[model samples]
Target: AMAGLTTIRGLVPAIPHAPVAARMPSEITSREVLFVKSLDALQRRSQLSLRGSNLAAFAGRRTEDERSRLKRVRNKEDRKQAFKDFRAVATVVSALFAGLAVYLKYSDSELLYDFDITDDAVSIIAGLLFAISFQYSSPLQLLLVFFGKFETERPADWVAARIAGVDDPKAMTEYNAPAYAQVLSTALIGALGLVTASSLSKLGDTWSLSTAVGTAFLSFLYEVGRPKRLSSEEVVAREEQWSDFRQFAEARLVKAGSCHESEIFDAFVAAFPQYRDDTEGKAAFKQLRRFVYQWNPTAERTPYGFYKNVALSSTFEKGKTSALDS
Candidate 1:
């Protein structure tokens, strides 16, 4: 009987087993589904927040890079404009001096209005001579030639050394040439004017004090008004750069086997640090290496060889040519 009862109980479904409809929770009918939807919405919001942060970081980096590029371009333009402005001012001053010279030459009776000669004939001859000599080989032309020669034939190592503030006698010699030339030219011109005045006085022709004063003033103006005479601020800035260059050059010389190439490269690099990353620097360095190591046998020899050679050879050649012509 018990076995039969057990069988009947097994045939009955368990109390916990219910229809799917009856198993549904009252919470689903009330607010449980809404809570689940809210949870899904919160998860989506979190994902969007992370994506926004990443985008913002990317944008910030891009902005910084753009700012850096723009600043560099602006700085380059400013430097170019400054150089142009300086050149323009120099050109205007030169033009004014030239005009004064022309006026003086034209107004002088000896130059343009000789008493014995017809005005038109004398003026034409004087004008032609003046145009040929003074106009063609003017101060501006000389200045340009001087700088051109300096930039070309001048030893790059010498300039690099000067920029580095090297104290070697050779370096000083190289540095002083340009200044010497300027002073020499001024003195020579002044002397020529004086000689001309003396000759005129001997001929019983007097020149006004105003003319002499004007000649002196022109010489002074040309010397002082030159672009090479830097402003106080520019001098200070260059001196600071020179100090840095000297330090860097010294350090570099101590390295790289203490060779001349090393010294030259170090000086050049310090003078033009902006070129450190460029192919120009590499080429310069290579050339410097050849100059110091291959061309020069004695590294201890002063760097004044080229300058001395040019000065001596040119002087001798000029003397010989002058004698021959005479």
Candidate 2:
């Protein structure tokens, strides 16, 4: 009797998805049956995994996706190495300029008189160049890359991993600790540049202004030339994926007549489990919300905060009445 009861319980539908089963008419459509089955499968898989499941065979698909992502990251790293190489060159150049600044500060160089450039001017120029180059190849930036922080090429996956399964205090205070190294390194580098400029400057006071000027100028240039982070191919692929998602969402909304935010979010996550990452989930939600608003210029909100196209008002009303009846 207990074995029979256990079997019966196992066969019963989950509460969250029961409405679909209950609302089925005597002659149910194939699409409705498929949707119910998909929901059941997702629920079952979610019980097994901490992260929710999707409609597709997530295990196999995720493995394949991981391989593809690794390949892309490898390619990105190859491209990023070029920037690092440039920065390394900048580091060397900055060192050389620093040496020149020191040499001019000590030596009574006749060259400055020949060129009509005052020693103060030459010192400021060398210091400016050093500061600019150092911005690209700062000691702190190089060191942070080793620990995998504050890098343009660093993937979000690692940060997510670091904070995973930790309490709020541990997550903030331990895993996601403050960036003391960055601050210290920045201050040291700035001080070195200022001293180099001041020691070499005749006025001994202009280094402060010169370093600031260099920082502002280099920051502007860096901003202009900074990488977009996504490759051309990735950008195109992302657009295609989003297009596919938009189509799926539109079809699902039309089938349901209307949907609340949670329903839409669940539907999207069911279709694209890869976006389950916290940051990605937020982005996907924002995109989906924008799509919803754009789908119907005059959208109406149901009593339960569901959104529906005004054109589908009749269908939405019928669905709502049926749901309430069930």
Candidate 3:
């Protein structure tokens, strides 16, 4: 401990014996700094708050100006969120490539048991970029952790409908917003991943192009085998028929003395509620409708089918006999 203390004491000039209360933290660190050794402004700015001096004010102003230089967007909050998300994404991507570059560079140099200027420069650049990228580590780390949540938990169909201009209030709250947030998060991660892989490795070269293409191909493969259910169009059509049938059978139809076709269909559904919404029930209803139509299309009042009669199936009534007539 004494040796380490002496080593540090040698680097720092002797602080003349002074009262403990009299020594300030800045006085200790700033003495050597006045000699003009290159100090990193951004590195210090990260620790300093918005206060004091021209340098601090300059840093604050530059930060604000840097924020405004992004693409013009209608929503200020949205643009701000986008910047945070992408920066996080970039940090993760840079770390990944930097780590890989370290191993690759070290391994390649090991074959001859020597290092060259090119290898050293590449490794240094990668290390520096990784450090800068991860300067504010927490946000990007959280972004990585949440990536899976967005990809898996978001409701896809409702989000799709919202994107296509469906403005349903309930859907917006229950499905659209949550799902949209997830999708946006996932997109930011993807954008960062692609940009990092391509830019760092060199665009249009085998590594970048192959990385992009492979990611897309794997995504395609995953989707192609995924189990898909009924389409939105088919669901809409089926529900329309189901709704109309439900209203007609339960509300409009009644078992009155007239024994109308609608009444008979309603009776069937009432007896078999399990099949009430099934295709079989719909077929039976359509069959009963034929019995309710009169032979003359111009007539205001049509005869009702009180009982089963095959003759009622025909529109022609020249000499058709009904079992109900007996």
Write candidate 2's Cα lDDT for 89-110 as tens digits.
Answer: 3554455556555665666767
Give the clashing pairs for model 2.
none
Q: Which is the leading candidate under TM-score?
A: 2
* lDDT (C-alpha, whole model) for all candidates: 0.41, 0.51, 0.42
Candidate 2 least-lDDT 10 residues: 166-175
Per-residue CA lDDT of model 1 for 54-98, tens digit only, reads 876786687668668966976676577546534533443344435
The candidate scoring highest on lDDT is: 2
* Model 3: CA > 4 A from native: 1-164, 167-197, 200-207, 227-233, 241-326
Quote the positional error of residue 167 for candidate 2 in Å.
46
Which candidate would rank higher by TM-score, 2 or 3?
2
Order the candidate numbers by TM-score, best to worst: 2, 1, 3
Report the candidate with higher TM-score, 1 versus 3. Answer: 1
Error of 1 at 172 (Å): 46
> Cα RMSD to native, each candidate?
24.2, 15.9, 38.9
